[model samples]
Each structure stands twice: as C-alpha cells, then as structure tokens.
Target: MPGLAASVNTPFYQQHWQQIHLPLLKQRQTELWVCHLQCRVPAIAGNKWLKLKYHIQHIQQYEKTGILTFGGAFSNHLAAVAAAGKAFGFQTHAIVRHDGAVLNPTLAACQEQDMQLSFVSPQQYRQRQQSGYLATLQQQFPDWLLVPEGGTSPLGVKGVAELQLNNTPAGAADLICCATGSGGTVAGLALGHPQTAVLGINVVKDPSLPEQITALAPHQHNWQLAADCSGLRYGQFDAATLQLCLQLSQQDLPLEPVYTGKALQTLLAALREGHIKTGQRLVFFHTGGLQGLDGMLQRQRITQEQYQQIKSAELRLWHQFG
Candidate 1:
C-alpha cells in the first residue's frame, strides 16, 4: 500500500476500548479497539492527517502554490489545513461559511497559522459545489489547489485508504467504524478493508450521506451509514452526549461530542439494541477534534469544568505514549 511519507510525522497508536459506561459491550462479548494517528501539530491528528496527506503531496508534486479550501468558521478541516500549511511550508486560504465572521478559536488558530480567511454567507456557501462557482474560484486563484470542504476529494479518499485499522493486538477486527462527516474516511475504509464491514456513525442527519459514501467508494459495497442517536444537527450536541464524553474520558479516550462522541454514542445504542452481532471484534477510529473543545467552551456549549475534564484526559492519553 502507498502510505504517508515519513516527513508527515504522524505516529499511530492503539488503545483497547475500556468503558464500563456501556454495559452492553461486555454482555455482547464484543472486543473494541480505538486507533489514533497522532500528529505533532495536534490539529492533524486522527483522520485529518490521512485525509490531507495526498492533497499536500499533490500540491508538492504539481508545484501548486498552496491549498484553497472551504469550511465553516469553526471547522476542524480548516484548522488542520492551516496547521499543515504552517508545519509543511505552504500558504493556506479558506472560504468560510457564515453570516458574520466571528473570530472563533478555530478561525483564530487558522489565522495564527497564517491562513487567509474569506467569509461567505450560507447562501453563497451553498454554491460551493456548483461548477460555475468552482470555475470562478479557479480563475480567481489560478495557482491554488482547491480542496473540498471536509477534505472529501478523490485524493483525500486515496490517502485515507492507506490507513490500516483492521489489525489489533488481539486479532483482526471483523468490523470497523468511524465518525463520518463528508464520507471520505468511511468510503476509504470500505475501499481499504473489503473483507471487513465498515460502519459510519453519521454525525449529521443527512439522508444523502450513504449516497455520498457510495459515490466516493463506488467499487466497494462493504460500508453503511447509521444515524446519530441524538439526531442532532451538525456541530450541535445534547446534554447526554456531553456527559457521555466526560464518562468516556475516565477510560482515557477523549472525544468531541460533534463527531467522535456522537458516533460512539450511536454505536453503543446499536449494540444495546441488538443490532450488532455478538463475539465480533470491532475497531473504532478516533477521528480527533479535540481542538474543537476550545471552540465549544468559547461558545458555552460545554462548561469550563467539562472542558478541563475532557482536556485533561487528552493530555494524559498523549503523555502515556511520550
């Protein structure tokens, strides 16, 4: 398999899933493992680095000036790209979707990384997929490589397919799961692990997600999408989801509610509802968005106490490998 070059500097780590919070996991005899791709730059941790890996390579290979992408003001994708641009020596720009350009922690980090920001209204943002708008962007920034929002391009899927998540210390997983946003990661997983079942716990309530995944990994039929248990909108989490994130932190698996926590909550709901088979090995990809905690706290979505609790868990988890 073509893997990420050594220079990207992402180290892989696996942690056996341990959380008594979900009692059904024990009753079902399901072995769960969590895998992380730890990047020194932090924002590129988890699926971010893998998804952006090839995009960066394309820029370098083709001699493109930098990366031009689209995202919301608090988007993890934008943060990752900005950090990547700074760490890897490239310029970065983002077409941000928002009625007002508030300097949230995520956008602030992008600026700190020297990423240029251009705010667009939600109506204008909706035109991102239109060919006319894309052509205009191409004409405006001729030297820049325009990446899709959430990094779900063909090259992004190619990069994500290089991840080896089926292997655990115990054995190979019968099923693999991840928090699916733009479908690239799940699609890539299906392409990479054709023998295993891939489940995407969709954080958004988009009925078109399965079709999106299908479009990305057209040759593979090993993947499916499941709705989030809370049925919350993208970037929104309920109180129960917040509590679950705090509870899981006790097991040293830090997760943000918008993606990872919500997805795992849905997965646990499935296991408890008898949707998952017993005696099967499952591996969950921890798609990191810990950087979003600062934004969550700033937006008052999570209390300062909750933020400290979850952030501490992340600190301890990383220190173990240090």
Candidate 2:
C-alpha cells in the first residue's frame, strides 16, 4: 500500500465480490469494453463483495485486532466500513461531518451495521489528516485502528490495485476512466497500469485536483483530468442532468445525481466530441452509488409511478425489438 498510514479493513473486498465484481465479470465478455464505474464510495461496496473475503479470513487468524474507524454522514464509505466492521467482529467508529444534527441515510445504514457514530464540525473534520486532530482521537481510542477517510491511503490503494490484476478483457484498452474525489483509486490504477492512459472525470469543481492527482502518483504519466462540470455543484444536481441520471438508471446502470452520473455524462460527451474515439477501448469505472439514488430521486421529485411507467415502456420496447 502506497498511501495508507493506518490499519486498513479487509471485509469490503468480500462484500464487493458478492455484490458487484463477480456479476460484472460474468456479464461482460467483450474483448474491448467500457467501464463507467468511478471511485464513488459504493464502488468500494462492490469491490468489497468481489475481493475482501480472503483478507477477512486471513485477518481472523491474527489476534490483537482493533476497531476500524472512518467516514462521514452521507458517505457510502461509512456504510461499507460499518458493514465490514460488523461482519469481522471489529468495533467501528465513524467520523461524520457536522452539517446537521440528524443522521443521514448512509449513517443510519452504518448504525444498522453497528458502527458507533461521532460528529465533528465540518472544519475539524477537514483537519482529519492533521497530526493534532488524529493524535487526540488516537489518545481517546487507543485500541482503535485508524483508516483514512474515503480509504485513500496506501492500504486502500492496495485494495484498488486488485482491479488491475487478472481482469483485462482481451485487446489493449486504450484508456481507463474513473471519477476522482480523493484521487486514491485513480492513483492506484495509474500505478497498476503505467502504459495505459488513465483519465479522471472530476465531479467537483476543484482546480487543484490535477496537481493533487499528479502529486499522488508523480511517477505515473498518461493520466489527465477531464473538466466537465455539467453545471453541478458538489453533491447537487440540475434538471437536465437529473434527467440524464434517471435515463441511465433506467438503463439498469443506476447512477447517482452526483459523481458517477457526471462522470458518465463526461464520458459520453467525450465520445461525442471525439475525445474518446471509436475502436479505442474505454473503461469507465462504475463506482457504486445505488444508495445515493434515493436522495437523487427524492430531490429530483421523480415519482415511483413515473419510474414504473418508464421501466415498463422500456421493457416492452426491448422485448419488441429483441
């Protein structure tokens, strides 16, 4: 692991194997293909199902294990961490943002997974990597093993690096695309595939992200950022974009109105603009966000009736065509 400074959890791999990766490998048999999954938190859930089972089993062999701590209120990371903790008999602590008093859906999910929730002011939460802050928490929970937020550390990157192992579809993939929030997943991918170009589709409007990515993996080139804002504020969505998200969701590739949807939009736009040329394989990482779909649909005022109608029509059309 190149970035993790803490004791990393391994149960996520098992969860991902069961939920996402195995199905993906089974369904997708093309030589040259595209992956729309990004580095969203749920992506970790899928990864957990696909890969972490063995690691969990191995960790069980060792004694003197400690609790794993990570994440914020709305974070799918928190949910995954919580689930992983419960399954592995490790105590879990979640550091959540102090935006509000109420727990978000993800935090509630974490609660169900038996993760203890702790709230810190947004500013203090931002200082998570600071020595003073971490030291205080370390002192408080001496037995707790820390995991970096969003799991962007060296150990986390090690988990992500598994994506590149024994998983190529056949022909050379010209480009690998992902959405970068903390930059660890892309960093791991870049490290794993030095020859293939890695493209990051940023959902946030962070001007410093390119430099951040470069800093994370200085030795790796052929990685660049695609600046397509799509008029979304971070974690916020617009009408047209929400429509696109709904459309994509209807296509069985459910995407949230946040990062993954924007990344998908960027990828499609790149294809239209000739940036992602035909015959050049593009793999868009479909980082998981099925949970976020609830918030997105709620915010967009998308009704269940409408969803049923649309799905029904699409199914009918598909049946007719097939």
* Candidate models: Cα lDDT each: 0.85, 0.59
- Tens digits of per-residue lDDT, candidate 1, 1-322, equal 1233336534433333332335677789987788877676677888888889888888878888899999988899999999888877888999999857479999999999999999988999999989999999999999999999999989999988988876687788888999988899999999999999999988866677788888889889889888899987898889889888999998788988999999888888888888998988888898898899999999888999999999999988888767
TM-score of 1: 0.94
Q: Which stretches of candidate 2 lie over 4 Å from their true place?
A: 1-44, 47-70, 165-170, 297-302, 305-322
Q: TM-scores across all candidates?
A: 0.94, 0.75
Q: How does candidate 2 fare on TM-score?
A: 0.75
Worst 10 residues of 2 by lDDT: 13-22
Model 2 agreement with the true structure over 1-322: per-residue lDDT tens digits: 2222123442222211101222222333212243432222332444333233323333454542544555556676666666666655666777788787476567767788778887888887888878898899888877566766666665566556657522444445678777667677777788788888888887766676677667767788877887655866667666666676666544445555577667767776666566665655556665665565544344445566544544463344334334
Best by the TM-score measure: 1
